[model samples]
Target: MTAPAELDAAGITDPALRAAYTTCRELNARHGRTYFLATRLLPRERRPAVHALYGFARYADEIVDDLGDGRPVVEKAARLDALALELDRALDGALDRAVPGGAMGHPVLAALADTARRYDIDTRYFRDFLVSMRMDTTVTDYATFEDLAVYVHGSAAVIGLQMLPVLGTTVPRADAEPAAAALGEAFQITNFLRDVGEDLDRGRVYLPAAELAAFGVDRQLLTWCRRTRRPDPRVRRALAHLVAHTRAIYRRAAPGVGMLEPASRACVSCAFALYRGILDEIEAADHHVLHRRVTVPARRRAAVALPCLARAIVARTRG
Candidate 1:
């Protein structure tokens, strides 16, 4: 459906709010290719909420990772702090009372606060997300996966938790929360593997340091491989190990797909298949993710999405 149709279906009528949601939808379409494709399968009314969530996330991520802008770490941290405060005001219904350059002035925050209020999503999830975003300005690499879990819980797992209200569920929401969080972790791990090269360029290593060490790999060795544009046997083994580890996460997340309300299932299922397909592409490339990114081919994406789209139509019709 078109943006207007989506907003109308969601009962959004305020001009400023519609504009904010439109901005978010644009962000999602431009940056979240796989995610946007899956979102197309959701009931139209739910699409704007999903876009708002993605926009909120994508904006924060760009603030942390916008290497070309050359902002200092301190500046980035301050910006995040300001964003967190603005979010608080937005959530508190104080956006209209703000001074210049405040909560009322940011479109992404506007859409997010509206969605949160509409769905009654917990406020703590947003707070936890900012906590992780703040860590990016200081923490470089994690010492172990266990240590990384702290960051991931805030950065990824809470994202899944935040979405539960919007997605609806067949069981009690708490019953599906674990699997939802697991799916988020799986997606984040897949991203860590695929973007290992780019993350290294940003002076951050997401793969656990200890795990890489087990394969006789370290930042310097990985850097050398990146610099030389060649893969090492050890690096391949390390990446292969990570690939298998990520698949385990996907397995853990699988059960939640069945727990989502029927109308929402097709969208989540399509996303699950496509995100996991990245691992297939990475392995197919012989674990050469150190120098380049891998993606599911367009044809493969269509192959997965078409069937899901049909299923989504049928589910929506039945509902």
Candidate 2:
């Protein structure tokens, strides 16, 4: 509903492309409530690029998760493959290329293509992300954290890697990559904690079997608890362990916030606090993530946001 600030900062002038980027921003605002909130702390020109990135990820995710019901697994795999091919073409400088049969006038792809070129973001990151989405269609559970890292590399880590360019880091990418990756994985693990029940409904388990076993928890027990709405002490213990692990990762990721360009610092800092707030919410709710999604309250969001908003305004005014 808000006007996308596209004229000066993003260098987008074409009416069609501006509209495409606006559509992506709308998607980011609609579905990724926390993400969109953090994005608001970015300088206005920078917001659209972040939104385009989210749009690209969200489009592929919807194909894998939302459209999966009643469809054959083979059909879903084919769709993913088709999308990968289309993405490949777009990244290779051919936006108008049709997806095999017909023209695919997807605005997300259009905006993503523009953003990728603008920021010189690597195509490999996009490739890895699509690979993970493809894996989600078939892989239901992980045996070990090490085994799951293979999936997380693509789904989570590369996302931060992709975003680093847009965020404009102060140091070489190699110097910041570790912190970026740690932060990304931390956010993803937090999601796993909050969405255990929902993932079970989709016939998936994100928690590593080995780690769950360490806490005396298992998939069958988790499924039973979800069905019965009974909270097990062991399950609570397992979630607490996960929360602690994610907190450590957030610590590892924290130093990288200072590595970003001054104007981008507040945005990433706000995101860091807001996402870490979910873990705090889980603790406050007594780790009852199995029953409902835990969230940072609007008042808490505003509280975190107010300081970052002030910092961002100062950064922009000085620029």
lDDT of 2 by residue, 162-206 (tens): 899999988998899999988889889888988889999888999
Q: Candidate 2, which segments miss by more than 4 Å at Cα? A: 94-104
State which candidate has the highest TM-score: 1
Deviation from native of the Cα of residue 287 in model 1, angstroms: 0.3
| TM-score, predicted candidate 1 vs. hidden true structure | 0.96
Residue pairs in collision within model 1 = none
Error of 1 at 57 (Å): 0.5
RMSD for each model, in Å, please?
2.5, 3.0
TM-scores for all predictions: 0.96, 0.94
Q: Candidate 1's residue-wise lDDT over 238-262, tens digit each?
A: 9999999999999999999999999
lDDT for model 1 comes to 0.91
Give the deviation of candidate 2 from the true structure as CA RMSD: 3.0
